[model samples]
Target: MAGAAELFVWWVLAVVLQVFLTGPLSWLEWTVAAGAAVPAAFGARAVRRASGAGSGGGARALHAVLVWPVALVADTGRLASLTLRALRGRQVRGRFQTLELGRGTGAAWACTLLSATPGAYAVGLGRGRFVLVHTLPGPPGVLADALTDGRRS
Candidate 1:
């Protein structure tokens, strides 16, 4: 079941990415996107199984899905600002912030969502609630707050 879900999700996302990032696409491009999604999807499933994160979650996964769109846009804009600054001979200031993380599958999902954005990458998960994230310096975005689990240490 998880494998099916992964495959479906991957296929959908790949198609969407190709369509959005490349503008108008030909049938061959669509086929390539779909063909590429299969192996990636299975690989994700295999990793999840090996890591014991296949247990998944309920509302938490839904929440991450909801938070994703907002975070993606905000992070992209932040990276763009950083790029503009760099181009104008200004220093690009990226920083690391430790954010609170949940346990088990929740932690994995949170990290995945946080890392998907351009401005932030979930660098490592330390002992306990330490999720080290490298991101462009800015006010905490909605995703960080969502993943923080309302506990700031």
Candidate 2:
């Protein structure tokens, strides 16, 4: 029952966001939001009831939407430079490197950082323990060493 209510709430929220973000809202949009809201609110209430705590869904959703722009911009710059060097045929060396990563979300973040940066690609991940990366112009051993060193510090 609680699960059903949460699902309903999610549906309503989705409709509301869609309308709010992409309006001039028509009557149809408002109607949809209204129809979805009941289920959504009910589901949200159920989820809260079952969990014995208030849901952080709203905060988490907002955070997820707002947190990526800076990272994306930084990554784009790195990729552009790396791509230009590759196009110039500048002695590009590519090799695989395995990095030890911190557990859980930390490892995921590290992988994202590596893949987002230019000249490096995360090819594989292993259970939040290690990541296999392919880096151009060789291993960037010095850069890798610096990063690993920083992690230690």
Candidate 3:
């Protein structure tokens, strides 16, 4: 089954990560990783199914993993610069804006990405097509730019 295959992949990944992090896995560690991987994989599968996201979910998830950290770092630096500028008596403005995301899963993904970054907070969802976000007076359209570009670049 697809779930079994997914679990096996996760199990292998866990084992590999354990080896990389702790430098070689004991039998007990292997057992623990195997046990943990099964439940985690199942939970992940459930979430993916519940989200009803389309077929490219894996690619999107991978892309997010690869680019999110870079974006987070960039956004944090930008936020700090803006904060310092504000402290120097420059005007800083924040606004609550609604964006049309066009799909439920897309909106959810966008919201999640926005909230995880430093300068943005995804506050609400509306009618399965819009997301409300607050940007903390940095460059506008961080979320919009990320979504449109399909990467944090």
Top TM-score hit:
1
Which candidate should be chosen as best, given lDDT against the real structure? 1
TM-score of each: 0.76, 0.37, 0.56
Ranking by TM-score: 1, 3, 2
Superposition TM-score, candidate 2 onto the true structure: 0.37
Residue 61 of model 3: what lDDT?
A: 49
* Model 1 lDDT tens row, 21-124: 88987899888877887777677666656755443556666777788788899888888888998999998787888887644335665777788888678888
lDDT of 2 by residue, 1-153 (tens): 856655665676667566756877779877877786676566656554663443333443334334444444544665577678879986545667776543222333344445655655778765435668887543343333323432321
Instruction: Residues 89-131, candidate 3: write the lDDT tens digits.
Output: 9997877766665322355455666787786787876664566
Estimate every model's Cα lDDT from 0 to 1.
Answer: 0.73, 0.54, 0.63
Minimum summed lDDT over a 10-residue window in model 3 is located at 144-153
Rank ordering of all candidates by lDDT, starting from the highest: 1, 3, 2
**Number of colliding residue pairs in model 1:** 0
**TM-score, prediction 3:** 0.56
Q: lDDT at 139 for candidate 3?
A: 53
Off by over 4 Å in 2: 1-68, 106-120, 126-128, 136-153
